[model samples]
Target: MTTADTPPRTLPSTSDNQLLADAGEGTRVEFRGLVKDYGTTRVLHGLDLDIAPGEFVSLLGPSGCGKTTALRVLAGLEAATEGSVRLGDVDVSRVPTNRRDIGMVFQSYSLFPHLRVLDNVSFGLRRRGMRKKDAARRATDALDLVGLDHLAERFPHQLSGGQQQRVALARALVTEPRVLLLDEPLSALDAKVRVQLRDEIRRIQLRLGITTVFVTHDQEEALAVSDRIAVMERGRIEQVGTPEDLYLRPASATVAAFVGVSSVVPGLAAGDRVEVWGRSLPLHTPGLNGDVEVFLRPENVLLVAPDGPSGIDATVQESTFMGNFRRTLVRTADGALVRVQHAASDHLEYAEGVRIELAVVPVAARARTATA
Candidate 1:
């Protein structure tokens, strides 16, 4: 509910700024051999990463990929069974959660119902022995960072779900944490609000230049806000890179399959090229191969006239109308299903049972070495 029409608010008070400076302008994070075991089940396998100061890194993967466990270890909430967590070069593997200078916000808005928004934010400062008046002023300024200063006097019950989460953010930041940990903080909000709040969180993090570690299973969300993304799987990091790196130049078959809509087309491997759909496109396979599989994105498949060009013959099965692009499903002559995407304004007029030829873009594509 925070609107742009609201008056522009200045930064927090000098006292809070001093506290942040003392904590440093974001701290570097190093996870050396980070491992976690719940009894006999090892969730993390020697995870290693070096997060630069003030960088926004997202731990992204499927549900049980140990991203959450890694975040917990960094926050000192959970100890690593084997490995060390280094924050700004100090080994804090054995440090307790309370003694660590990190702020965390979870999926649930853990707001105090008994206190007002300002008081909730200032609670940590007040507990640390700041005067009543100073804590209130600092809390107000923190709320202003998240655009919740107008609601400082309101209670948790009076705020919307998004507002309540903003209050939680203000509370975490009011103490000037060395690092901010977010565990799927926007998961509970509606789709629209989730997008809005995630954008705001990214804006605030960049504005403060604070080190942040975000854990999320949502791929789009990770791609949207992260400076880099660590794609994890089976207790280890598969690859770590920017969003474009992960999508365009996947390191392995697993990465190519997991990151986006990678559709495999039946093909024949001939040296460094693969003959897929009547086209000898550029392809690279590490080892010797005869029959192979080529992966192409939906948008990579082009639609041409069924008569003139000798492209792959397919029968249109389904067509979907997205806002900017149209998604159509087709089955090749050999009964292989392929999905194609084109601009919404100029897509193939292929309806159900309409025959068409799909031209595979002859760029660098990936192929499997062996036959299935």
Candidate 2:
């Protein structure tokens, strides 16, 4: 494992300072009517999205939802069955992967086992016909951006999983590609290291102002780093919005259920409000009336006094201590189960009787007869 105490073997050259100062906004990326298929299986169905210059966007969904395929299409790794990909103002659908000028970091580190970290990062520059001395300086600068320059002399086997991933990141960025594509790059590491690297990637992307497309199934990771998230399901984008927008105002039932932990409970809808457990809460998008299923977030449900007149009587089934907060599962008298999230200090034991109520907030719901 590499340590911060290890001194960097070389100092940054004058050109390195100029390179760092020249960091500018990245190119815009657009996916227009993108579709993909493997034989008769259509993986992406007319997907469309626009990413602003230097923005960080995440394509988030479950496995086989085509998040990876979408990223690959943009990176020129896979050809779209139909439609085109635009980098800035140019259509690059027919462009080769190497000529597209895009950098990609995959789930695997994909580092050369026998090469030193410095050489591994400089390989792309060397392949592009840069002189060895120039390539080494540029590679060192890239490593410095990721705080890994001190480990340039170490081989891949001498590094930890996180360190290896960082080197892979350096390798990708050494070329200063117009866009950065990350395909669940942190998924292989342990939880703590994953978070650390995830933040590091975001930090580097911001500093370089590189337009980035990240693919991931982890909701927390997406929520923490992305400027906007496009939630995909069944080969199509279900919803696209910021993390708070998706969590608090999901455009569809699929988004509500997929983006966060929502409990689907039966409710009655009338006008702009939904009545869940005898409490009338505002609706996020008011259109449906009559019987409906409300998507209730754990944080939106609150524990009230047992004798509170507006609350429904419930029995606590379980409570999980989640550091800063506590999540407790409760079953109402009518057999509807709900999870309530509250301050960690507000502890409740198993089998304890309590009263719970939904906070007076707008909630997303769909008709009971509606399908996802």
Candidate 3:
């Protein structure tokens, strides 16, 4: 069995109250004609989306793309200038933030300084009028979920940044909110801790089966955790799909460049064939005759003997070995800079100013708009 299947001892029924499956077929969190404006600036432009119940979705984009605004609107923190927000069958456009029944974890650790870790986790339950003793019981369980129950007596100041963030997460989950909203919750941690906490957070979220919406500018984080990702640009959704679909078959060049490192070259499309440099290659796209740009990921390019038919004359400008892979920057005969990644094997070593060969088959080429 896969690791994702090994988490639960007893399989929970998808229809059971605990399982929290997608709200029926149409049961979803829907944004219908959503729009947000601040004076002269509009943040969301007629946005429409449906998030299935129990699904983990990430809104990924650069800053100023209105992803946060959309999250806030769903949280009832920001009023939509136009359109409605629906949570399952209920219209929550007019619901107050406290009545929305959603959990939120922010980049900033918002734990109260005077409260112990246990008290911080229990705060939301106490606010909802649970008995003090009962609230502590629920809080303790939540901390255990995050593997921080042993630190319950410590205050926020006594914990590291990652532990503090886990406390914040425990507090959010303790309320048993139907929907969870995470706003760059791992952005404050150092790089190594960020990856560790990221995995921990995913494990916990899936264990709970809560409908989650994550907003992030980090592409890796979005790709790592999301069941589906929505890429936003200029307050509009550019595309929405699984991470593999988005990475391997980006609908547009904007998405291709944004999701990962890419090397672009000019090409011409004739029928199903695309001509790049001096070669004609088959494409998945339809007929086109004008100029196009072909995007090739660094990992797809290989450096080999100059005499090979697929090889192009090149000179290595620089090289860096990153343990598992070697990154080489090569200048093609036409003076175009190309970055290639090679496996860290004995045969792949190259030094600065070394003449080399670059070869690529048509299958490795993907065309994007010249303008993108």
Candidate 4:
């Protein structure tokens, strides 16, 4: 009987191998109160993190937020001033970079120009004193895993940008490291290649079931590839959750503004009630009164008739067609600009001098105390 037609054998899925019921118990990586300091300036402030046996996590944040520093510590490239680093119940705080059993792929493709693709991938294995035949066999397997076996004989300069990156991935994975560290591996590629390779990398990582920590400043990439994301700010973790959770329910204003576009409008607040643009909303929280900021997302804003009596009067300031969506900039009576996104096929004709109305849904309104 054909494999598909026969009774299927139970094979492990990626989630089954990667996701743990109790993350702490099944965790393969842990950073306990980790800290990194540069001279007198402290970078990582008592950072704590945990990753299950094969979970794919992305350390997402702006530049200089200590995300990269933490990754370096995990890779044994940087020493933490305080706290401990453990891998699978073993402390590796003082381990050398090569002895840490971890693989790293940097944004720059650091392949050797004098070596062919096959030799480049086999370099790590050869350094470990593997026989030439055995090293070549392992190198071929890694190249096949990355779908670059056909390019084994090609030199680094003979390959395209995306191909070189794949070679780097193969080289890193050939070591059979337990933990994989990715430092903006796609940041150097063009937009089209970036999107294509993003999925390819995730696919290969899933197939291998290796625990990975990816560091990137791009929000879209983080949201697309990560199984879970840890958002960092000022050397501290702001929040950690699935992509949908962070987008739908942000814990603070910094998170809301950082992850997506938001319109902050002035409003009058009074004990769980706020009035913005002449519309009232229930704040539903305590310790918030007087003047407050109202956060409205673009997807939650709708356009209405220009002369509608109940809508806020706004003048169309500018509009741009973005292929899939149209971005319209509207100026309120107080000269505040609000960006609204509509589908490209939205048939609504608008001009720079035209008057329009802005409507906000009840669920999208949020009140926050002003931050200095």
Per-candidate TM-score against the hidden true structure: 0.90, 0.91, 0.89, 0.88
- TM-score-sorted candidate list, best first: 2, 1, 3, 4
Best by the TM-score measure: 2
Encode model 2's per-residue lDDT on 25-134: one tens digit a residue.
Answer: 99999999999999999999999999999999999999999999999999998999999999999999999999999999999999999999999999999999999999
What tens-digit string does per-residue lDDT give for candidate 3 at 1-372?
112223433323335422223322222688999999999899999998889987889999999999999999999999999999999899999999999898999999988999999999999889889999999977887787776888999999999998999899988888878888999999998887788778777767776778889999999999999999999999999889999988887877678878877887677877777877677877654445678877878887779966776677889999988999888999988777888988878485488888888876557356765664
* Alpha-carbon deviation at 306 in model 4, angstroms: 0.5
What TM-score does prediction 1 earn? 0.90
Model 4, 149-263: lDDT tens digits are 7889999999988889989998988878888899999999888778777877787777677888999999999899888888999899888888886777776666777776788
* Candidate 1 per-residue C-alpha lDDT over 100-171 given as tens digits, one digit per residue, 9 for 90 to 100: 899999999999999999999999999999999999978887787777888888889999998999999989
- Candidate 3, residue 210: CA error in Å? 0.3
- Cα displacement (angstroms), candidate 2, residue 95, comes to 0.9
- Of 1 and 3, the candidate ahead on TM-score is 1
Clash list (residue pairs), candidate 3:
none
- Backbone steric clashes in candidate 1, count: 0
The Cα local distance difference test for each model comes to: 0.85, 0.84, 0.82, 0.82
For model 3, give the 10-residue run with minimal summed lDDT.
17-26
Could you give the C-alpha RMSD of every candidate to the true structure, in order shown? Answer: 3.1, 3.5, 4.5, 6.1
